[model samples]
Target chain A: MKVRVGEIDLHVQRLSPDAERAPVVVLVHGMLYDSLASYYFTLGPAFAAAGLDVIMYDLRGHGRSSRPTTGYRLEEHIDDLVGLLDALEIDEPVHLVGNSYGGSIAFGLAAAQPERVASVVAIEAEPPVEAWSQRLGDGLARAKPWLITDEAIDLIKQAKGDHEARLSRGAGKLLQTTTIAEDVLLSRTIDPGLADIRCPVLALYGDESVLMEQVDYLKANLIGCRVVVLPEQGHSVLIERTAETSSLVLDWVREQSLVEAE
Target chain B: MSVDVQTTEAGVLEDLTGMLRVLLEEYGLEDAEITMATKFHEDLELESIDLVTLSGLLREHYGDRINFATFIADKELDEIIALTVGELVIFVVEALR
Candidate 1:
């Protein structure tokens, strides 16, 4: 469904239609080449089957949502998420699950409004830190070729066959026409620190993932946090290990709920 | 992928076929040519997102009455990618019945 949040239309998908009063678990997705489809295809139905009402949304300028030429910063994303929750009338403390960039948003929100978040599960995401500014800059430099180069854009447009042609055009619009590539390179200062996040947190990263140092930083900084390393998995662990990752999330949420009730 | 035809709904197949045609049109397939035997990935060349959309549409129209995800639930990613249109139709048919 199209959720209007601060002049932007966000695409929100619920796992079940009759989701009133169920344990709410909201999912946030990664930036660039990631959408609500990642969770919608893999973990969402699993969560719904486990009796949790799952919510996943496309970030600004991604998926079926409207691509505003700006607002790619973390603060805007936090506002977009909080506003969407308000629009949906979800007042209870809900579990927040995020992958890669989505994990960063989850971290920002939990730090900003710890009370609103029951627990946070970061899948291959790092908490917002001052040092991340440089990291994001370096990452953006590496990504510029595939994202902004005219040759890459031409190659994306040259998708063969009629079926792929449609996907190629849509992808080109997301990458070339929108300001996502440029907007994402600049991240606003995250107001709250990881020390400010008081909620229960579980961080997951592949043992082989390049972001191991970030995971170590998460363990050292965030209060009441536990980190897990998936064996033989990497940054794309969500796709490479869907069943195991979903199982981990399902079990984590259950344990967290039990502790909260007690 | 193995398609279980035991749950096929003879009554609803025609209406379901028509719906499939309209839905599959976005994938460059003609609605008139979509049949019970049409493959989702091979014939229609539908991507994972497309299957997700199809499932969402099925759930929207039929609600919880027809659990379409169960058809692809047990399958691995590759198996889901290989599923045919007939498999999906039968799953919906069985759920409705």
Candidate 2:
């Protein structure tokens, strides 16, 4: 469904359980060619079947959501989420499950409005620290040249096939046509120490992922946090390790709910 | 097969084909021929994201009778990727039974 949240219309899918007052679990996907489909095909249905109300939406400038040429900063994405929750009139605190860049947004919201988030499950993601911004800036800067070229797209098509080529083409358009590259760099960086987030957090990472380096920093900072590393995996843990990830998340969310009920 | 079952399956297949055509139009494949054996990923080139939209359309048409999410919940990703139109048609037909 198209939800009017502030300025843009977000494409949202809500899967409600048969039970009443089931805890809400919001699934946020990664950036650039990623959408709610990642969760919809894997974890969203599983979460719903386990009696949780699941909300999945495409972030602005991606998927079916309204894509303006500007306002692609991390804080703006956070505001969009806040507006979406408000528009839905959900008053209770909800669990946030975010992948990649989505995890950064989840941490940002938890930091900015600690009361709105009950718990967080970050899959191969980091908090939006200055270092995070710098990494993204450098990555996007490096890819911008090749991404915007037709030759590069053709090469991707030859190597990866049509679906991936289409995604690459879309990403190229998103990068070339919007302020996202610059705006995301300008996103307000949270404290590197992550002291403001009071909610319980479960961070999942692939043992082989470069982002694993942040695990120690996260453990040293957050008070109530747990980090799990999946063996023989990389950045694609969410898609590649769907079953295990789903089980771990369901267990984590259920445990948090038990704690809340206490 | 009973005459009644054949007729019912035919009706379900026709309806599902219409729904798929509507979805395929967005990808500029509106005029493409669809059949029971047409593979969603290989033949039509429909991405997993397109299935999300199809799920919504299924709910709108069949209400709660067809639980598209639950239907594919147990299937592995590879299985889902290899699904054919006939498989979905049978699932919908059985679901409405």
Candidate 3:
């Protein structure tokens, strides 16, 4: 469904169990080539089947969502989430499950509006800390030249496949045509305010992933944060380790709900 | 095969083909040939995201009778990647039963 959330219309999908008043869990996908489909095919149905009201939406400029040429800042993404919750009239605090860049937005929302988030499960993600901003900026800067070139895209098509090449092409377009790269770099860093997010957080990372570097930082900063490292896994934990990731997420949400009930 | 089974399979295939055509319109491949042998990822060159949209169309048409998620849940990633139009048509037909 195309939902009017503030200025843009976001493509949102909801999968709920037969029961009413189930805890809401919003699944936020990664950036660029990623969309709500990542969760739709993996976690969305699983969570819904487990009795959680699962909500998945395409971020602006991704998937079926409205693609404005601007407004891709971190806070703007947070604002989108806030507006979406209001538009949906969901008053209760909802759990947040974010992957990659989506996790940064989830953390930003939790810090910005602590009352709205019940718990957060971040998979291969970090909050928009100074380090994160710097890393993302450098990464995007390095990728820009390679991504924007037709030669590179064609090479990718030959080396990878049509599907991968298509994804790269979309990502290249997003980077070239929008202010996303610059806007994301200008995102307000929540480094100092990390302690303000009082809600429980479950940070999942592949043991071999470079993202594990942020796990200690998260544990040291957030009051109720728990870290889990999946051995023999890499950055693509959600896709590569779907069953394990699913079980871990379900267990974490279940635990959080049990804590809430007490 | 029985006449009834053939008709039902053909009906499901036609419905899926229509959905695929609509989905392919964005890529200017609306007129692309769609058959039971067509592989979603390979022949259609559909990203995983396209499957999400297809699932939505399936829901709108079949309602609660066909659960696309459960149908694919048991399959491995490779199986899903190599999925054929015929497999989905069969699932939808059996589900509608």
Candidate 4:
């Protein structure tokens, strides 16, 4: 289904019983993509079957939502998410899951509005802005230079193709500084400002992933973050290592339940 | 006799940077604009996050070819600035050899 958050329309996929007592899970996708037909095709149903109410939405300018040249800022995305929760009338804080860029947005929301979040499952995303930006810059320099192009929108639209094309699309988006709402969600200055965010955070990455080497640093720094590296996978752990990803998330939710029982 | 001195002093440095650039490009940073003087921080604008991410990418593609920790620590920005792409290539070739 689709919902209008503010000026723009958002594509939303909500799962679970209409019953109020059901646990809630919200899945947020990263930049230039939406939820319904994106990552949700795999990750969302798995979470829903794990006995939680699941919510997934396409960010503005993505999926079935209205596309504008601007307003793709992280704050705008967060506000849209808040608006969705409010409209749905979900009075309780919900479990949040985010992947890649979506992970950054999820962390931003949790840090800014701690009242709306219970726990977070961040996949292949880094903390705050400073580190992420520098990493982004480096990744751009190393991966593929030809990806930086003037026509980023067209490139992103063509992203769902084969490997080389997908890589180009992903690179095109990453290199375009203007299209990316740099400071809003994944800026260098935006600290996950909520000091009281003692909520459990599960940080997962692929074992062979270059980012895995630094997961230790993130775990050491973040207050209540735990790190797990999926063996033999790269950046797209959700797709490349789907079964393991599902099991890890399921085990985490179950573990949280046990902790609550105590 | 004096070959080792010339090779290590200038030849090795150039070769290393070239290889590093290729590695960086493979990870998606082809426009890195790297120079010998490009400090991972001040000059080239690389941070721990970049290094970490690059190391992760490297582990996947060039695992047998390089040692991330040692290579990362060894190449300071200024040390890298004087080298060219071709020289950098030779350095890596020697290292691999």
Report chain B TM per candidate. 0.73, 0.88, 0.89, 0.40
- What 10-residue stretch in candidate 3 chain A is worst by lDDT? A189-198
For this target, which candidate reaches the highest TM-score against the unseen true structure? 3
- Per-residue CA lDDT of model 1 for B1-97, tens digit only, reads 1143223465456656656677667656664466667777667766665666666677666666766666666666556767766777777776767
- Tens-digit lDDT track of model 1 for A1-262: 7899989899888875465577789999887667787787778888998899899898988766778877777878899999999999888889999999898889889888877899999999877766665676576655555545566546655754433444444555565565555555576656335667788899899999888887667766775688889888879877778898899999999998898889
Ranking by lDDT, best first?
2, 3, 1, 4
**Two-chain DockQ for each candidate model:** 0.28, 0.54, 0.55, 0.01
lDDT string for model 3 (A1-262, tens) is: 8899888999999998899989999999998869987888888888999999999999999999999999998999999999998999998899999999999999999888999999989999989888888888778767766898989899999997777787898899888888888887888888555876778999999999989888788877876689999999888888888898899999999998898889
Identify the superior model by lDDT, candidate 3 or candidate 4: 3
Please, what are the lDDT tens digits per residue for candidate 2 over residues A40-104?
88899989989999999999998889999999999999999999999999879999999999999
What is each model's TM-score for chain A? 0.87, 0.97, 0.96, 0.80
Measured with C-alpha atoms, the lDDT of residue B21 in candidate 2 is 94
Candidate 4, B1-97: lDDT as tens digits = 2233224435545444554676566557667765544545343433332343444444444444644434423343223323243433344456556
lDDT-wise, the better of 1 and 4 is 1
Regions of candidate 4 where Cα sits further than 4 Å from its true position: A33-36, A137-145, A148-178, A181-188, A192-196, A257-262, B1-97
The number of clashing residue pairs in model 2 is: 0
Model 4: DockQ against the native? 0.01
* TM-score of each model, in listed order: 0.82, 0.93, 0.94, 0.61
